[model samples]
Target chain A: MVRPVNPPASWWRSGLAVLVVLGMLPVIGNIFRNDSSVSRCEWDGQVMRPEAAVTLELAGRSVTCCDVRCARNWLASHSERPTLIQVRDEHGGDPIDSADAFFVRSAVVTNRANGNRWHVFGDRETALRHARESRGRLMRGDEHPFAGVRGLE
Target chain B: MIVNAYAILSLFVCGLQCAVAVWLTGRWLNSRRAWSSGWTDDGAEVVERNAYLMMTLALVLLGLDLASWPLLYLLLQSYVPSWPGVMCIDGVTRIGTGSLGASRFLPGLLVTLQVFKPLVMLIGGAWLVIYLANRATSKAPLMRRLLWGLLLIGVTSLCDGVCTAGYLLIPKQEDHLAAGCCTQVTSTTTTRSSEPLLAGVSGTELTVVFMLLWAGLLFLLLDSIRKQRSGRKWMGGLLAITLVVAVLGGLFLVDVLSPALLQRPHHCPYDLVSELPESVIGIVLFMAGSFWVAAGAIASFCADVPETREILPGLQARVLFLGLFSYLGSFSLLSVQWCVL
Candidate 1:
């Protein structure tokens, strides 16, 4: 049987050099993928999560969380509280005042934009039913303890 | 019909494919004419020269064929991040159609180009297979059968490519076309339950299934090597199985790999390459590795058969090794990114 010919030493050297170049690529990519000036999640400064998008009116400007769960993290970084916060309902996809929405805190269903597994439903029955089926914790949006607790009050 | 560098290169490849078909046919006719006239001096050397020329031309076509997929992907992706869901060539045509406002010429032409691209890619693979077979052994009968097969594929591929030239020549301008993202392609955002692979299985289970499938393909290939005398039929069976595995791997890549790279649930293959250099590297390797698996299987399908039986085992083993290593290396990279990296 004719054995397969082995590639030479220079092949290894060139291969190693190519890997080195490839290794540096992630560092360059990190720089490009991350930008300080773009409006991003206050929690991570990354782009807003599309499905988990929660917009808050706060301090004469808009504050957004890539994930609704990031709302707390954003609040912790700021002293002033938001006057209004709106979260989209998972079932209906209509934006509802966060104070009025029911939230199911679970890992069963995930928001696509942000990696948060929690989903918000517009009503208590639906939220509780989801929790029953998916083994999630049913709670009011304010129960998650964002500054919007005052809004619910 | 946006005539960019990729479009021009595709046209050139189409021309090259046609030229090769003509050349091969011409060579066959000349050989037959010479054979009927009885023995001729310098025939062997002339045949040798022709083989070298064909080898060079086949390699060039194969390179173009392999590159065309990624090239088409890259050209269209450059429009994305601004315009999403334009992953397929036809989706790009949709964008053009939207921009031109009720014009059939652009979309009609681009869609035709899309149809031809895959046909040509299939023929290109056949060309590579035939070239490899010719060099593998001096079995004229099998080569004759394979060449006939190539002729059918080549005629269709060439005709399809030629049909798109009129559409490609039109100048297309990019405009305010709000091409949909994956969300639009999919009716709802939470349609995961509808996916065939994920229908009854959890994501973790799907991952395990894919790993086992890949391992099984490797095991089968190794076993085929061990039983070389009886392996030819088994290799054909294995090829059918590997093709299934490759298709499943592609689905998994679309469903899981893209999302893993993005660190999010909703994912696009085009976006994976555009967003991360690592993703592009990993996916390119994965695809190339899988192709090699299919190609190597095809090349060795009839290796254990009589006539060329003595000459094919070594070639099969070598090609299989290339396929195996490529797949292993690519998946290893993917695994790292998924879990650790």
Candidate 2:
């Protein structure tokens, strides 16, 4: 029977270096890839669309949510209330303070999986128009969508 | 039952493994009986034939088993499109859960098989290393022990076959069940269950600990390579410590590194794999490194046997070096990700 011979130490070292370099190739490519423009919701890690984006300050950091329902759900789960809450106006697509915005629970669902139905608008007329068109109800700015719902509160 | 080319191939490989395992088991028993009866040199040729046949079939089964690990994921990924709301492999895993009128057996078996596949591969790889070392000897002194090892591998492969077949063959309902994906189920926050293990350690701190452990393991492996005879003394201890480090490494990866890699606060390993496909290289390197370390340790233990002592040291050195290379490669790749990201 022939004995198996071990390769030279230098050979092993060279192989190691080559393998390490090969392993880093993809990582190097990743560094150059532009993924910064894509924004994902903080709550569910879903990609956030510009039109339906909601922003809230949690723990001194701005957290983006996909819609009003996610933002509310996030706030309800955390012990500390958000210092600032902002939602994008559906008509103009500009961020507006949640307090100044009119929320319409439209029949049109924004996010089906999370059951998001409320649409935020800077103008009451647009909110009423959306409510009428979609057969939705206007919710007060201070109203909690999940309030009194079991386990959500 | 998402029938696709990958699923068909997996089932075929699994079936072949099952058939080979049964054949090998029968051969092993016959050989054991022959050895027990103390047949003289007249039966040496028969024994040699049996050993050759069994070893050949076992190696093939081992290759098939190793291939099945990757194939399992491919099969799952293929099923993703068929299942609504199933965006990732995690969703495909839930298919068994939502199957109409199906017992919990299918999902439970899938999980069990997932856990077992790696273990089977590790053990089988270690056995292959030992067999090679033994084969280098003129006398083939480790034949009896190798036979027992083969039997153990055969049993595992048989079980793997059964589990894979059950998972693949069991029909799943086409009804689209609203199964929660990894994003919904994987908790971003640290939970009570992990609190004790973490002991309030932050992700950065845990990463630091993990790096330090890897550094220590690499040093030990280097020392073992330099001093082969002395290395035998701590082989068992090294094995135990390595096992602990592996567990800690896995925890660090899933909880800390995965989120960091994916740039998501609430990311799971599935997300990391899906988003950063390159990270799979890091995972594979780490797993391969861990397996080499374990196999080296097992070989060292086997070297305690008088007949196999001569060739085991060289085999152990080579295996330990491989482990070092793999661990270093994985660490370097992860560091690059950490630094760049």
Q: Give candidate 1's error at residue B22 in angstroms.
A: 6.5
Candidate 1 residue spans exceeding 4 A from truth: A1-153, B3-55, B81-130, B136-142, B149-153, B156-160, B163-201, B225-230, B302-307
Listed in order, each prediction's TM-score against the native is 0.59, 0.81
Q: In candidate 1, what are the lDDT values of residues B1-341, reduced to their tens digit?
A: 44556667756765665565556556545544554465467664454455455445445545554555565556554433223323222244455543444333666655665666655554455456545555566555364445444444445544544544444454554444354673222222211221334556566777778879888987876554444422546667777877777777877876677666654334345455555557577666665555655665666653234655655655555456556555655665566555533
Each candidate: RMSD to true structure? Answer: 11.8, 5.8
Q: Which candidate is the best by DockQ?
A: 2
What tens digits encode model 2's per-residue C-alpha lDDT throughout B156-275?
999999999988887765333454763223321111121224547788888788878878888988877766532555888778878978998888877787767765444356655556
lDDT, candidate 2, at A20: 72
lDDT of 1 at B324: 59
Which ten contiguous residues of candidate 2 chain A have the minimum total lDDT?
A144-153
Tens digits of lDDT, candidate 1, A4-30: 433334544664555455445555556
